[model samples]
Target: MTTLPTRTDKKLGLVIDLDICVGCHACVTSCKEWNTGGYSAPLTDYDPYGADPDGAWLNRVHTYEIANDHFTGTVHFPRSCLHCEDAACVTVCPTGASYKRAEDGIVLVNPDTCIGCKLCSWACPYGAREYDHDQGVMKKCTLCVDRIYNETLPEEDRTPACVRACPTGARAFGDLGDPDSTVSQSVNDRGGFDLMAEMGYKPVNKYLPPRKGTDRAPVTNVAPAPEQTGSPIEKLFAWADRALSR
Candidate 1:
């Protein structure tokens, strides 16, 4: 089994805001696009155009209809590797293929050393691991390690592809170990929480809970436009006028 680092200086991870994710799937698509050609290349799609299609993806978004006595709404959850402090995936690897970086706390699989055992995938609690059928190896989100630390890219564009592609700015990446970091402070102020904390994996990534109704005005509260009051030809002219104003 692989041994994990006793400590990591930087807990680099994501802060996902469930409140405004919008289920756009932008992050998922961008992640697949970037990684499929980068560090974890050739993310194969089996029978892509056939009846029974399957593929490997690093990130995925799920939509859930959350309901209870006090709250009711749809939640868009974007899930990927949480980069846990006590990563079961890393510890379970018979080869040293699975390992966590001591410098950044980012868990990764070395494809060259991996033997496609799938033990790491089975050990992960969050279901973040992906099995590359073509390569016969376990694959997962590297937090765009190739991009994040690449000095070639502009400083502002050095975040994970998912974070960069989020249309609503729902995903964030930073050093969670530093209390003063923007990501850490956002988590602290917004009551961010870990997924399945009882599992004891101690995930580095945090999720900001969906805000309650009282916290903001409900979408249903917005009044619809009043019915247009005018003759048929006048209404046509009015509609054209409105369209032209833009």
Candidate 2:
């Protein structure tokens, strides 16, 4: 079994705002595009052109219709690796292929050492790990380890691809360890919270809940009639783009 670092100097992670996300999947698309050719090259597609098309993806977005006395509406929830401080995937790896970085607290897998055991995937509670059938190895978000520290790319482009591509500026990346950092301050101001704190994995990523306001529409169980003018995909994207304007 593997072991986690007792402490990391920096805890670099993401703080996602649920209110701002529009379920656009722009982050999902950009994550796939960059990581497919990036540090984890060839994210793997099985029968892509055939009817049973499947591939490994590092990021995903899900939408939920939520309601309460405060606010009621659709909220776009993006899910990915939380990069827990006590990462079960890292500790469960038999071959030591999975490990969390001491320098910045980024959890990662060494594909060359991985034997495709899927142990790490099972250990992860967030379902962040993806098993690539073609490579026979577990994969997950790297926090764009290759890009964040790279000197060649413009300083502005060095963050994770998901953070860079979010159309609504819903996602932010920075050191959560530093109290003075902007990310930390945002957490303080917005009441950002852990995903599953009771589980005790001490996840690094935080989520800001949808804000409560009188401007929000009343909760409704009925689905809206579809707009007949455009394709379903077009309508969805169009809706996602417009959702935040309210």
Candidate 3:
């Protein structure tokens, strides 16, 4: 069994806004492109073009439709490793290949030491872990550990690839340990919440809930004109002429 650090000086994580995510999958594609040749190289795809294709991905987007008498809309959820403060995935690893960093609290798997055990994936509640059949090892999102602190990259480009790629500005990354950080302030203002808090993983990543649509004025319903104005055939032809002129 592995042990986690009692405390860390910094807790670097993501803050995702559910209201802004458009389900574009840009973050997903960019993450795959950067990480395939990055820290966890070659996020292998088995028969990607075939009828049944699967691959290891660090980030994924899920869309769900919500409907009721009063409200109906789509929710785009982007999920990845939360880098929990009390990570069960690390504790359950028998090979000690999975560990959380004491410096920044980023959970990582040492592929060289991993023995292709699936325990880490089972232990993770978020289903963030992915097993690479070719490498015979479990892999997951490392918060782009290789990019964040690299001096070679420009200062503006030091954040995670997903954060950089999100066009709607739905994703944000920063040190959660600092109360004064912009990400923390956004979480505070928006009442950002963790997923499955009941499981007690204490995930560092926060999600800003979708804003209520009630504040916006309701759409006015326009009724069609009565057939008494003209015969049905004549009305149809008139509508077509008006549409073409417009």
Candidate 4:
């Protein structure tokens, strides 16, 4: 069994804003492309191009038509590995394959050491692991560790592929350990929250709740337009004008 580090030098993670995400799935595609050849082995597909297509994907966006007092609209929730501080996935691995980096607190599985056991998958509350049927191993999001630390690329391009490809800039990456970091500040200002704080996993990734848009209804307690007393011909013209204005 593996034990988590007492502490990490840096808590690097992603902050996702629920308000701005547009459900484009660009992050999902980019993650698949980069990790397939960069850090992990080629992602496998089963019966793809057939009636029953199935494949492994590290990232996915779920669309929800949520309704509440504040807002009611389509919300796109992008989910992946949260890389928790008290990662049950790591501790549950019997082969010592699952580990968390002490330098950055990034949880990862050693493909060589893994025994194709589903303990890590069962332990993860977020359902972030994917089983590669062809390779007989489990796969998951690595936070693009290879790209983040790559010195060959431009400094600005060192972020994860998901962060780079996000069209709406809903995803952000930074050292969440630092109180002064932009991610931390955004979390503070926007009321960012963990996916399941009650579980006590202490997930590093934070999600910003959707904010009420200004363009929505009830623009400062606006009253309905008053009905005007007029001739039948005048009233019809006024109604037409009001409809056109709307």
lDDT of each: 0.93, 0.92, 0.93, 0.91
Instruction: Give one digit per residue, the lDDT tens place, for model 1 in 7-98.
Output: 99999999999988999999999999999998878788899899998999999999999987645899999999999999999998999899
C-alpha RMSD by candidate, in order: 6.9, 10.8, 3.9, 4.0
The better candidate by lDDT, 3 or 4, is 3
* Clashes by residue pair, model 4: none
Best of the two (1, 2) by TM-score:
1
lDDT of 3 by residue, 1-246 (tens): 379999988999999999889999999999999989988888999999999999999999999997765546898999999999999999999999999999999999998899987999999999999999999998899899989998999997899999999999999999998999999999999999999999999999999987777857598889996757678888899899999999
**What TM-score does each of the candidates earn?**
0.87, 0.86, 0.87, 0.88
Candidate 2 deviation (Cα RMSD): 10.8
Tens-digit lDDT track for model 4 on 10-115?
A: 9999999999999999999999999888776778889989999988889999999988987788899999999899999999999888899999999988888788
Distance from true location, Cα of 72 in model 3, Å: 3.4
| Candidate 1 Cα misplacement greater than 4 A, ranges | 218-246
Candidate 1 has an lDDT of: 0.93
TM for candidate 4 is 0.88
